[model samples]
Target chain A: MTETLTAPAPETHPRYAIEIDGVGKTYGSGDGAVTALDLVNLDVRKGEFISLLGPSGCGKTTLLRMIAGLEDPTQGSIWLPGRGLDGLGFVFQRDALVNWRTIIENVLLPLEFKGRRTKAAYQRARDLLATFGLAEFEDRNPWELSGGMRQRAAICRAMIDDPQLLLMDEPFGALDALTRDDLNFELQALWPDPEKTAVFVTHSINEAVYLSDRVVVISDKPGRIVDITEIPFERPRPLEIREEPEFGRIARHLRGVLDGHSARRA
Target chain B: MKKNPLAYIPMQVWTIVGIFAVWQACVMVLDIKPIILPPVPKVLGELFGNFGLYLRHGGHTLGNTLIAFAISVVAGVGMAIGIVYSKFLEKTLYTLLVTVNNVPKVALAPLFVIWLGTGNASKIAMGVLISIFAIVIDTVLGLRSLHPDLIDLGRAMRGSEFKVLMKLRLPNAMPSILAGMKVAISLALVGAIVGEFVAAQNGLGFVILSSQGAFRTDRVYASIIVLAAIGTALYYMMEYAEAKLIPWHESRRSHARPTAPSKPAKGPVAQPVASDAKA
Candidate 1:
């Protein structure tokens, strides 16, 4: 972590919220080293929604973790502007809700940690849970809620403090298809707020195409970005759009590039 | 299926009733001498008749057990936390504890008596010596058992290590800590009894030992019954504390069933929230 110095994108105004410059990651050294990521570069504009889509072991998660500041790139650097990396909300594949806390308390946890919890903060947490259809379950423990509800609670927690950036790692990957569909809609509903940027990592091509403004395909083993396909579709896209021929074509195109990099993936 | 917990009362009562029946049956059928095996009525009479005497010694035993157990709880959990947060302590203190625990703790009773003298200090020290291991070992395991995702989440939130330890780690370790306490409390009681056996002049253990020496077999039986009651009480007290403290834990949840029903299912069942399978 101490070895690399991140230089900001050469832009003066900082149009990009995140600038990932030729980042690479290698674990260990000498005899038994493993390169998890190759020299990968990406720039996500402010308010952009991007998905790093690839099969497992493609180091997509590793890349996402680097962006979240949980890991450091072995080379190059990631420069996060605006709120920077510290002021961000993160959702894990598992709900990762603190089971002992009531849903509201879990949501307020980050704020509490920040020493910023106030009466208004509590209200904000309540409103966020209510928006996620979890108002009634606010006082209930995480284990008492269904999987989808628990994840919604987790999302509420992530959003409670109005973080400028959101990082989600396969947030809906564990749920049933119907529940996943529900959450996807819920997420899309809130995505238009306040130029907040999000970097999502997922293995599902459909999820990438459906939710992201652009899909970045990554190759397996020493993951490198193979393609970045921008969606031409309009905002607040209805679920019916996925039925369109163009949507299928775009999804298939991303999948084809992903498949080209490694083996075929569902 | 578990509508009324009261339904299990008869089951519990009958099991105890059945054990007493077996005891009485053995006494009658074996034709044991009255001095050797007091009849149920005689023993019960001795218990009620000498309730004051039992109460006095019982109080002494209970007091020593609780004081020693409290000290062990504080020291044991403290040591566990220390071991978890410091590799130095983990390497030295924890390793030493593991080695020390393998020795029979009762064998150390005379040592405590010699070192701390034949008073509450030695008795309490013995109780702590016998019981502290479970707390340290279990609490350490529980503290280290946090899901890695939780650690990452803590980091993602920029939570300080101390904040994470206090708010997340400690609460998560509570169930394990309480479990250790349950075992420790019983062991503490046993330690106090061993201390009393080695040198003490009072308490239930001394009562039992002295009564046996005088061939007052009924008093010995009475003191034992009281001791059993105390051990059972301590265990259940710990269980009650565990249930109250961490009812959300899966192990404690069956006892805390959601009897209030769902919160009237708000929001439409068909949430328009699902974005049309978007592109």
Candidate 2:
């Protein structure tokens, strides 16, 4: 496991999009305080797809929230060197679409918030919806759609702003296996463009392997990075890639690392 | 697609008609005294005989209710916004509002009449006092009930606090605020009647009391009927407004029946003949 795991290269003039430096987060105060993340350092290069894979109690979500600037780290800072905070997009486990807004309006929320509702923006929103197969349901209320459809609309919304960084916290965790597989493919097609970066958090090792270029495994209860392994799969991976021998090897390797951490904690 | 118009009548209307018929029959069969319980026809006659008097008093009561209801809505929504936006107001003003709401406005009616005089002002004050609490509580709940993830999305987009409040919080709170308005409107009517009972020159409440003093039970029954009609009218008016404003809401959608299935349409098609020519 140690041989396969490699530290991120320290570039001299790094064009990193997001750099987390020794970040730590603690909730509450006095004796009741709980540490969520500690000494977490990672560099997400421009256009890279990374996954934070950990158990439920691990601070994977907290880390993602910190990067998105929704939560503050108690000890360290997340630096997006050149990009503004506005260049961040987030997709939560829940679709979180406003019930009152129609599907098209929900997708256009960020643009509306910025007062950028030009004709071009509208066309772009419609095009994104069409790509995600939600164009027919544009006028319908968010509650009228099925769960998978709502999640797809939510992803469309996050991408509408063309953010430099996309932080997704188990976006398909609530979905069934078939729908999850479908969305995983859609997400793979949507991300890793030369202009955008994505950091995904998931508990499923297969999901992390299938969607990510690099998988950062974290330990439970006060999360800290345990191993960072680069997947050697080529681009445009099919569903059949999960059946390949190398896919099984990497998944078993991740499971072994997770089991070792659990044993030590016990 | 067309259907009978009678199907549009709600079950509630049938129940009301049945109640009136039973009351009329019981009065004729049992030989009950008119003073104790007037027959439905006598009450109807009273209502028609002095229609001008009932209309005048009914108008006064309706005016007072509408004015007070308007005032309570503005003040209640304003206070709710204040509480939602500021933690200080949530802690202090919200608790103060709940404490004040617990004191019966009926008990305070005489004080209002004494201070503001027995004109429309006192009655309107009483209405505002009685109805404002529910509006405030419900609107505050609605504004604060936004999903945290939605707010996070807004923040990630670098939306200003005012933008979030106007675009996200207020629109999301509309259904709940409308629900509160329904409760408040009814309470406002009660408050106005209570105020008229304490001291008033004219109103359905004053008519009922004056008729009771003169032992004109039929007129009392007539006035009671007018008050019930006013309450029902106001409630339905609010319902109409809610339906118009939030057609997407579940409450409005529940009123619609599923549409009929459509027949499949025929289209031109190209058929490939069975061929066995492989080159």
TM-scores across all candidates?
Answer: 0.92, 0.89
Fnat per candidate: 0.44, 0.40
Worst 10 residues of 1 chain B by lDDT: B270-279
Q: What's the C-alpha lDDT at position A186 in model 1?
A: 83
Identify the CAPRI category of the predicted complex in candidate 2. Answer: incorrect
Candidate 1 per-residue lDDT over residues B109-174, each given as its tens digit: 899989999998999998999999989988897788777788888888887899999877887788
**Residues B1-279, model 2: lDDT tens digits:** 889898999999989889999998888899888899999988999899999999999999999999999999999999999998899999999999888888876899999988999899999999999999989988888787766777787787778898899888887778888889999999999999999999988999999899899999999999999999999999999999988877765656675553221212121111111010000
Residue-level lDDT for A192 in candidate 1: 63
Error of 1 at B89 (Å): 0.3
User: Which pairs in model 2 have colliding backbones?
Assistant: none
RMSD, model 1, all Cα superposed?
A: 6.0
For model 1, the superposed segments whose C-alpha errors exceed 4 Å read A1-13, A264-266, B1-9, B255-279
Candidate 1 overall lDDT versus native: 0.83
Q: Runs in model 2 with CA error above 4 Å? A: A1-14, A29-31, A263-265, B1-11, B250-279
What C-alpha RMSD separates each model from the true structure? Answer: 6.0, 10.0
What's the lDDT for residue A160 in model 2? 90
